[model samples]
Target: MGLIRKTLGTALAVAAGGAGYLTATTNLTTPLSADDELWSSRSFKRFNRHRNPSIQDVCWKSIPLSDVRPELRENEEALTMEFCRGAWAGYAYAPQRAIMSITNKGPKTENQLFDEQQLASSKYELGTRFSDHFEVVERTRNSVTLRGGGSPLEPGPREVDGLFVISAKLNRQAGTVDVGLKTVFFNSAEPTGKKPAPFFVELLHRYYARAMVDDGARRLTRKTP
Candidate 1:
């Protein structure tokens, strides 16, 4: 009886720890800045017309890139795109992707989702599509805006409901690059008493957003010599 009780206690402890981790948000994760360009975007403005408390959040993590291969480090565009690719891969191939595949709706492999030719070109221009669901709305030297138009849990016509702005901005002063992901939702059915999303929904979204940037930073570091 004691052994069974101990085992149950341990399991409960593990579950509590995981729940805490998922809900925790650090200083790097925060509400979107008031002056962010997305606010001025036509699509953003249109979707927000109803004054719904659509979620707008950002999370950032920095990784040193000074030791990266000279060719990549010197080419700002290349470095930025590399991080973007890594970040998108993290989102597209995370454990959630595997769970989604159980229903035979998700891509069997990464190759099925990404186009080799487009990835090779690494030219992220306006209207560029990734995985046939996310479309690029803007691309600057350090950041790219991707508008998601499909559901990961279901397959059908693309429908835009939100966007993400991923950035790899070099901080010369710190000899590091900040990889950031910002989420702006166009619509929501989730309840929001005084927040953009319910407490539990915000918690999960924050954790997921941070994980995407963290994965990208880790991938970039692995590429560094």
Candidate 2:
């Protein structure tokens, strides 16, 4: 089992630094749209237009309608909720809870940090807090945006603010539902032009973003018979 895991990880590293990685535990699919279209998406525009030194990334994976859980196949909103829930369970949040634990804080489970009922609902009010750091700043039928507060895993308002968005859209022509996970990080002050993040920081950021979208899509799909 250990040998198989290592070989698979090596294969994935070769396949998709620009492409993807896959395993029983994780899957990273190629982008669902062309580069031009993806970069021009509405969600992409939100950060690109306003923040000067901001780093923004959007990862997308398409799941065939037939592959999704039967109950959520036709419901974009529910699919979005499910994706949000699954993304929180990605590699990022485990350490988040652990760091908080050192201080005797944080929730025991991801569900407690991100309430199942709230995640499943379409009506998340602005300012709804999650964990000790994140809060819903925007929400719609098929999308929700969270803003981070001060925490060891997140920067405070004084330095930088973090935004994460999860969304699902039905692509009827393709007979698939596209799930998107986006993240933005930027200083809170006025525009200072484009300054890229440190190499390792950007690397880790992209990996985490992809893991989240992949994990979320996996949950929404059914195992093949």
Candidate 3:
């Protein structure tokens, strides 16, 4: 299995650097209009943007959790969700801050897409799996970013086809400053997976769904912001 592991590792160029490793994940936005397609019958066949989550908040805490790691391996008896950071072995060659166009091609789904081997190539395991039922359609771009927090701050938002930025907005309630974001993914990828790639895709789907919710919550919640 080491042969396959190393082969997969090299195929993805994960050994090229120290920060290239990272698990694959995904996200979204937009308020649906009454006549909007997201709420139309074509899309409603499977998805209901109507029931789509409300921002529930305007300004918030930490950035969304949509970028968390993707994996299922855990040390507990419970099959709970986890995004362990240390588990990411190498990430220098991994895909981060990626941007891609995904359209659901599934007979029963929409907005599903994948990019080449990102599902399992490199670091930042981010650490856990995305959502299940999520599938690939097309990749517009794939890029990554490494963030360094406050205090002299280290390197940050190193590269991108697209990137995230802090967004400011008016707070009617607080009459003070409010913050959020504008995250856009780069479009540089191919939808292909090898050997265990299918498994990776499945895991990606599951992880994405949860991450979207968590991320939105983090970004929209007044408590966290």
Best of the candidates, TM-score: 1
Q: What TM-score does each of the candidates earn?
A: 0.68, 0.67, 0.19
Ranking by lDDT: 2, 1, 3
- For candidate 2, the clash count comes to 2
Q: Candidate 2 — which residues are off by over 4 angstroms?
A: 1-50, 104-125, 149-156, 194-196, 222-225
The per-model lDDT (C-alpha) reads 0.62, 0.64, 0.25
Worst ten in a row by lDDT for model 2: 23-32
Task: Give me candidate 3's TM-score against the actual structure.
Answer: 0.19
Residue 71 lDDT in candidate 1: 57
Each candidate's number of clashing pairs is: 0, 2, 55
* Error at 85, model 1, angstroms: 1.5
Instruction: Find the 10 residues in a row with the least total lDDT in model 1.
Output: 151-160
The TM-score measured for candidate 2 stands at 0.67
Window of ten residues with lowest summed lDDT in model 3: 78-87
